[model samples]
Target: MSSGQGGGQSGGQAGGQGGPGWQADGRRGAQYPGARRRPRYRALSPLREHLREAFWFAPLLTCVGAVLLAGLTDLLDREIFAEASAAQTADTLLSFSSAAKSVVSTVSSAMLTFIGVVFSISLVSLQMAASQFSPRVLRLYVRSRLIKATFATCLATFVYTLLVQLGYDDTSDPARAVSVPIVSTIVALAMVMLSLALFVLYVQATMRLLRVPHVIDRVTRESLQVLQDYRWLAPELGPTPGAVPEGPTLLHEGRGGVLRDVNIRWLIRVARRHDAVLYQVPRIGDFIAPGTPTVVVVGGSAPRPRRITTALNVGVDRTMHQDLSFGFRQLVDIAIRALSPAINDPTTAVQAVDRIHQLLAVLAPVHLGELRHRDKDGAVRLVQPVPGWEATVDLAFTEVRICGAGQPQVTRRLAAALDDLLRITPERRRAPLLLQRALLERAVAESVRDEDNRAFALTPDRQGIG
Candidate 1:
């Protein structure tokens, strides 16, 4: 990963530097002086991000809604029972004295037991996903809406039944016994049936999570969405200028973690206010260590350290926000793991390559480099480093190419992928594809017998048909 910071001499000049000019040959240049100290700024909480991604948030809210509904039902039951004529009361009232309460109590107990079983099954699924696939995938299972909805339905039914049972009347006097909420009991039964159906759906959904295709598709969908939403480079936007010499201090703040996300909008606003240019050192997925500078600020008066720190939301793991490489990282991790000696599952690796090709195809035509954010007047405010086309291509194939060596199936699939990319990709993007092709050809030449090399060298077989 590249580290170090660069700045521009003028605000307009900053936008001209289309990519990271400071770093050459995938290595950082000499380090500049340390950053000056400033007032402490408040760090934004990741709680909201967590809540949005959290599986429990939806279910917890559902439980609260269910409680409110139960109370409304209780009120209606009281009003109807009190106003009903003798005939109506006789029609709706249950014949058993207190059997309604017993039935609800029984159903609630069963729901509680079922909740335990559902959770146990979910835990087992999680264990399998973590052990067999990457542990990073645990978030997908934990935050699944289907899983959350299932748990919510189960809890809602239990709460509704328990609440309805409280209104059951078993008084000694026959007149008082008529107060039982028979309508509420019927609704509770309906919820019980719904819960049963949800359980089946939940099982099917969990099973799908365990499948390789489903997992890769989900990640690809999310990554593609991020690419579409950003509107990265406006059509009217002009070319960026070359970078200026380093002047402002480099800010590291000695913080370290997997960079989960950067609030780009917030960073833009800060840069505009301070009339400064900011270059983010690491892309979203790159890990940073303590004492490593993450951002280099140039121009304007030095902003408060907190302002810079608050704009970054670092965490223990990478998220899908703005970090397109992380998606590739997850799929690549699975591919290499499958190629390992112990696993020896080339088919699984091939499956991953198919998805990786899909992602690269989506990314191929898009403009990727240091993203420049401008104010209303078109003056550049923030300039953050992004993975260039070549870097992203290398990220997609380098590891798999190395790990899958000597395995004809994996190598052939990779070659076919590169061939496809080379044809579809624009002229500027072809260099990386050509480079990957040459590398794969050399690997095949060294690993396979001369007779086999010729077969593998033929126009890349996307499906490894040979």
Candidate 2:
């Protein structure tokens, strides 16, 4: 997102900035307001960069050579005729110039049309390249391609015009005319076509070459998603690799002031957005990592918690126990209900599971460093992150403590909301199973009734008993 153009244009690192920078505190500074510093490095000169980028230098040079050769041929033609009939040669040369003047003018006009065509093609190529690359890197690439294309097009047009004009100019003489052979003319035209074709191919190759990194980045991001979805089996929780610490962890500091008791309401909202259910451990305060299903979301009606995880594989560490003494089991059940139906059907199941998992990943492992909590003195404090990766629950509890008994009610409300969501998902698959069961029950009842009627018909005493 820097202002400067990049890629081979600067011969610097593809996206590298020329210096040092500051890491984000998640807020842009006042003076710098949303500005990020560029990385430091020296880049190649523009001319060299241009040469490297176009990758068309060799083809361009070939065209230039053709133009030069045509000029030389014209000179040789004039020399050969000058010795034989000076006066006649002069007259023929004059006529040839007159004839060529008009053609030259027409060719120039044609070239103008070609310029438009080239421009349109170049724009399309740039657009395609931008879309093909990462969104973050597109604009820079477009600018670079546009500049290179414009320059190359102009060079090609000039060379082509000169070469054609020289061909016509080379023939002169009345008695001993030095006219171009039809075969030679055809060959010259063919060479021009070949050169142009090569130039275009070069540009295409260059664009494809630049796409490699973008492809890799996309792959890496998707891989991260796969990791989250399967985190249930991973040794560590969250994007980073590490286990959440057990017992009392320091979430942050401050018994009072701007930061105080962790704002449970706001945290709950965040949890919901991620589709995670939050359960706070009772009396443990915000300072201790608490409970399983710390972040819960509805899933399929499995008898046991499956080895489910997230695409980002981030969230509460299943192995570490956060002592969430609060009766949050209800919230966990609700989340399970909400998530259950979506996962029952195979088609949309995985995506729904991943989405729910992402929600949990975002909220559950929220460490104490990410929270605000209060001390016994009524002083509020802000927790800071510790070294390395830790489960969000562990991190949230690391340096925080709970305040007041009213907290459980708020937690209950969250649980209720999740339960409501689950009810909406409705076990549609379960409905079919229920219908099947009902039909089976009806058939049984009918059979029993028929059997009793038959028996009564066969035996009058049994019938009376029936």
Candidate 3:
């Protein structure tokens, strides 16, 4: 995680460096004990990212659009109603004027109640879900386009109907609306129909969101999208590790946060401009305090510290953007939470494991490479470090395996996850899964007392039970 200022801010890549870099291994010689600042990235504001993921954003936009649409349709009605040829159609609409007013009033009032009651209940349910699953899932939940569309349509219909209702003529007759808005009334009715349809869809979506398996699937899909975005060199295809170039070092100079984003191309351009190699000391996702060495300028003039730090973005939480491992962290959190003593929900943990397995299987064949970024001439202009396969695998399986020790359901599902990965994953990438399998076997044997339960736990069952 680099600097996360906001808009379009990405998560850390699995093994790719997001611009800024640092060594966890103390290989950078002497360290600056007291730090100064963890500078922020230039592009992608935090507000923009929040708006992108925020549930209110779409509805707010739709409400504004509805206002403009109501006004536009009012003008359109005047144009159509003025023509002598339209007299017949206008008279026909006037006949049902009372019904139109009733319909508009009904929709405007009903939509308000529907939004209030449903959303109030939804917020409460979502809070409960955050506790049962991971709080992070809440962020993902609002990201559903259907959820946004549903809220947007409901609000828009309310606003449009209310405006249409106001234009109805009540002075001419108490029994009926004499000056009925022709096109506007039709538009309002159409909006009402759309809102009703969306309500049904929204209810179904909300119900699915409450289920653990669906949430896991959503998270997994986001992670896979991140994984699919990387065009970097794979591990086998990457260059050999070279010593950090000796040069002027730029230290972080802002408030510390998780390294969340970086413009790698920007880093390369800066390095290329100075004819120096830019070596990022802090990997994306590393929390850096002030005085922490970030970018090392090698073999050329030192680029301004602000210039180097600008390439990195920092944020309070990990995103699914460029960070491949962040997804794994989330899935693991859900698994660990489910396996906690108080919850002891083995089935939920199994669902989380299923996603973990899915992500690992996708990663197995990928050849993750070095964090080296090169210029047009093929010379490496920037170099950042990424976690290797072993570290990533450990992050995904170790914690869940440890927490799931005594639970037969969790252990068996984990075994199945490992075994499934072993079968599909390339031979070279199978080591970590094998190691995890052995550890799972050892843990289950040591924790579960009854021979029958132990035997059941040791067997690989994708379902965790018959």
Candidate 4:
């Protein structure tokens, strides 16, 4: 009995020793035999990331440009309009009296009114999108260059016209009337016209936001660009697989939200400098709460917590920068919302499914998983978690499939989408596609009557016409 107890104690010690090497969430360790540790560093500048996501960044820039342009025009007025010959020419050219005050004032007032109208239209569109689609759609609007440009131009025009109006005072002295900067006034009038043109463009853009196809297409385009930007191919040597040395686990302390992006190159550099391997806990789109373990260090002393926090850009919502699944989530949200009883718009759901199929097809050929970053010396230093093809596929379709149950059009389109994925996906990845097809088939069986099942069970009809 004593020997048996001793054996149990030995097993317990073995288990204890092994515990730190493995993650509770079942992720593989960073160290693997026959794998060289090559650290890679690819960090997006925080300032650039902030600028890209900042709603005011573009507008502020436009305002600065307008100010500089105003200064240039003022200089032109001083240099050319102050000359006697230029003044004589100005007399022959367009010259506005103090009466033109009303014209400049009118333009400025119209610009202000136009700005309000543009904002009102945008806010209304955003509210509708948030309710009908998803609150996440608002990010698309915020990041839209067109929207920003429109706002900037309108605001810039208002400020310019107001400044120009201030400079125009015919009543002060008749001699100074010739130096009224007629050219600046004409430019302000042109700006007023431009603002009117932008108002029309803004209306068109807002209308596009209400269309499901347009929204889905926009998300797909953005996500594809992100995929291209990251060049998410598998590492040539693959991940090192073995037990990692136990080190510190860095818990996040910042305001909790979605894990949007990580400065991978920076993390790789830090890991290499410290002779450690850092494992990111949450995938890009995963929500991280304050105090959650975010990065696990192995093999050496951990870097400062602030360094890790700064390397990661957490936000209230996900973006396409590094989060591939966000686009899928947005598309799926629209699909399921369409299938909801209140909406009951199966056609829209089918449209979303088609786009999902396209995105999945693009992702099928790429490598997806924990991305390993290698340092200059070809040693792996950073291990960041990313959704594999299977996870992405699941995310793309699972919820929509469940929510779309009983909708013949949505189910048929889903079946077609799975079939397309299977056709394009390599044989090695066919298992997941097949499994999804089976799940979808089962769902169809339960939700649809046997008569309808016969049709859905056959080769999927893209139009649900089978």
Candidate 5:
């Protein structure tokens, strides 16, 4: 006999508090009136992640390379100076045993100073990037990056020049002697700084340029309020089971089949749920009207006993979890908003805020659960399953279409949003207050999109605000 054990879990009828799941006024009850509302998910942002990685890597590599190059150049310069002048300037002297040794020494000293500055800047950059949806934070990040990149470029150039001088003779022509260090360091520093600068500029300029944040903010605020309102409602009612267990009959059995034939499995499971006999249905999501044969629940034989117990520990399990997820997301949004400054360009700060809003919306499912209703005669019926539980589907940033050849909308949006969100907030945050403001923003955007769409459809040349 095999050592492995086999078991099957029994399907039990778990009772739910019966009634309609959602009340028409958009309130589950007094407690969770508007809590069912979920935000629409737009997409993910990758620009911040890329920026963070680049920020850290650039400085680390620059520091190490600069020091090594400096030391080697210093040694060469020492020998040249000694030979040319018949004397040595203290600054031009090299004490290391070899050019490699001098290079290492110069690199170490310069790196010690540069790393401290660059690393600190990188840390701030990362924090701001993570919370870049807030205008205040975005500004801080942009400023810090600008300052660090600028300083690092200068420092790297200076240190690299000094180290390069080590590799040449001081007496060689004074002009030529000066040219090598200056050019080498300047070129290296300029290359690094320029690349980083473009990124920073893209982020800052795009944020103010795009105005996506404002739209996002409005959508998010409306969604959050709608979801929050739902939490105040009464609990959902679940479907009631038939009076007793009805079937152990095999509807269909198969060992192998083609890919499309897998529909047989679903038929069997659905039949099992109803304790009924079933056959394959060709189409899905088709409606069954009154008197239609949905499935035949076998009533002749008793179902086989299952090894596992048929019981449930069900008090606010998944429903609470879902609600909490929405709640926490809302809180996070509020926190981000609280951290945002009032004054920022719409393209940068507003778009940044909007992106976060969209992210939060994606978490919302159309409906949470179902409710069953009972008529005066005690006949049971499923009133409705929670409606509109749509998942916001999207690929992660890198997974989406990208071509190194051109600017990407997601990255462009990210850069802009980050710049605005990182700015320092000029005022204290009031969570509830912000929520109201966001609601207003949502209303405005909704009206704009609707009106614009209508106007554009009506006319070729738009007259005014759509």
Candidate 6:
């Protein structure tokens, strides 16, 4: 990693240098149609990211909002309804206090039941998804705004109805209850209706978990988006992902976790302040433990370990934020699991290969080898390591190829996908695909019991069998 080179990287990038408060279009002026778009991901604040993944966060927020809304209805029942005279609207305010209580009482109870049922079904879906596909798919349910929205609405409706029910007077005469909780009751009814709609939608969304192809498609789309965003930002940040740490090593303290992603802005700022170039020691998906080397300073004095560690986000599990390889890991896991003797679902394995192929195709033309980051003056400030083309391709196909070698559908699809990727990728990037093709042929030869089936398995077929 050259810290001094500024020539080839000075032109044709989308905008910012992948740092915080950095401008993309050379200047941060008013927005335009062709303005640089923000990458699909940046390093999320560790705490905020954890909270977002929590199951109760959205429901808790909605419950708080429900409380505030209940207070507003309380004010309306007293201020607006009590101020009305008998001739002003005697007939309009004539709903029975018992009926008001019953409406809310029934709604609140039903909402709780609906919540219980929803939770039960979601748990069952999680189990099925884990058994049929991969356990990581549970994160999909967690990150889903639809699931959160449905739970939030259900909880909000329950709380709102229960609070609204409290305002009704059991002793108030049925015909003369001008202070009836009509406004509050109407709002509660609307919430219940909304909850019901979301519940139906939630059922459909969770049911998607049972459909293997839908899960494969969703993961593929997510990976492609991550690829596009990484490609967009990588050019401005570095020239290649193969950059190695060269200076005084900075080590992580206490316990360490998987290197989820790095805070690019903080790292750039720290490196700039020290007049140094920082090279990240591990790939994004690699785990680092206590005393593990996290970053190394090349030119200037290395910053304190805390400063460097603060920019490196270590977490319990891998995420798609920047570790594009994690997406490949997921698809491979599904395929491998499908090919397991307990499951023997070759169709699901084929579907997983289809998605893996899609991602590999998108990645083939992109440059992921560059892992250099530069400041405004075009001097390299940070050099980060990322999975190389060979490693990424291995992550995509090695496990599936080995596990599904005996299955004709999976092997054919793998051969087809690898062939397609080789055709489209540049010559420099073709070695991994070609090597993998040879390995697949070997696996097919060793695994297939008969010569006829071995020949068939080695045949490339985009449709798995056709």
lDDT of 2 by residue, 229-293 (tens): 22211111123323333322212221211111123324333433433332222122232221223
Q: Report the error of model 2 at residue 376, Å.
A: 62
- For every model shown, the clashing-pair count is 7, 60, 44, 17, 64, 11
Best model per TM-score: 6
lDDT of each: 0.70, 0.33, 0.72, 0.69, 0.33, 0.77
List TM-scores for all candidates, in order: 0.82, 0.27, 0.80, 0.81, 0.27, 0.89
In candidate 5, what are the lDDT values of residues 21-45, reduced to their tens digit? 3232211212123224322111112
Q: Which has the better TM-score: candidate 3, or candidate 4?
A: 4
lDDT of 4 by residue, 30-64 (tens): 23232222222244565776776676877788778
Candidate 1 lDDT by residue in tens digits, 124-152: 99998887778877889877777878888
TM-score pick, better of 4 and 6 = 6
lDDT measured at residue 92 in model 2 versus the true structure, 0 to 100: 43
Q: Which candidate is the best by lDDT?
A: 6
lDDT, residue 208, candidate 2: 58
Candidate 3 per-residue lDDT over residues 333-375, each given as its tens digit: 9999999988989888988988888888777766555555555
The worst-scoring run of ten residues by lDDT in candidate 1 lies at 32-41
lDDT of 6 by residue, 293-312 (tens): 88878898878998888888
Q: Name the lDDT value of residue 223 in candidate 3.
A: 84
Alpha carbon lDDT at 9, candidate 2: 13
Q: What TM-score should be assigned to candidate 1? A: 0.82
